[model samples]
Target: MSKHFLRPPGAVAEADFLGRCIRCGKCALACPYRAIRVAGLLDGLEIMGTPVILARKSPCYLCLKCVPVCPSGALESRVKKREQVRMGTARLNRKECLNWQGTFCRSCYDHCPLFNEAITMDGELRPVVNEKKCVGCGICEHVCPADPAAIIVTPRGAG
Candidate 1:
């Protein structure tokens, strides 16, 4: 299965999401962060016109705007907290991380919306992820100075 792709916040399981989605572009238009995008022809017929978030391009800020605009119930409309939105999980590649090599960088932790809850510092000041607390929003991945990004957010099922 392709675990790398993610649905928006409050999205149902993949099979159900694909079935219920009506291919409308409301969700994408409603997003203030412009994090949501409609799948292109290259994405395949099953996902065309469906809203998708490409975290590396633009991370969802959990503004919850896209949720209510999903008329077909592809995305549940009532999420009240950042912790309730599970887009994916962030993983750290220690070998490529500047902090792991003692450069004193905390870009991922600083950019994380969950901050201390999802990412904490160890005694060495290296960022540690609390997987359960991470919503996989991808802000950490976007802000990393590393060429390949030391921190990567994987879609929920992908990991």
Candidate 2:
């Protein structure tokens, strides 16, 4: 336990970003993947109530277990990819970002399958997602450390 293994992944949503968090811990208990947690109040944050953090031990396979049962609208699903409704914009939480703090962790980069396009490692070594290249799979969001998640997915809006 020297290091924090899990973290909040990108591809989650703001409205769905713990917006409906009820502090019930039901999401924590329901997570079969064990990606979610209740770590009380963390630093650099003002969690309204019980703070549920997503520990990225294992990456999300897109099973979407915690989405349906959310008592609050905390985990609303948004459409992204028109092909199969599997893609959207992935947002990130710079406040909790270890990379943003000059750390050397690129878990999301390693986990993301999209290479040479979706996730680009900047000169600073931080993973930067290409919105156009991103498919909005929600895999990153599900594995994020932030309770509401730094990065989240949003529905693709028609222009």
Task: Report the error of model 2 at residue 106, Å.
Answer: 1.0
Number of colliding residue pairs in each model = 0, 22
**Candidate 1 segments exceeding 4 Å error:** 1-3
The residue-by-residue lDDT of candidate 1 on 66-125, one tens digit each, is 888888888887676778998888899999999998899988889888879999999989
- Count clashing pairs, candidate 2: 22
TM-score of model number 1: 0.93
**Cα displacement (Å) at residue 34, model 1:** 0.9
Query: What is candidate 2's lDDT per residue for 25-99, written digit by digit as tens?
Result: 665566676656655544324343433343234443444555555666555544222222233556666776667
- Window of ten residues with lowest summed lDDT in model 1: 1-10
Report the Cα lDDT for candidate 2: 0.53
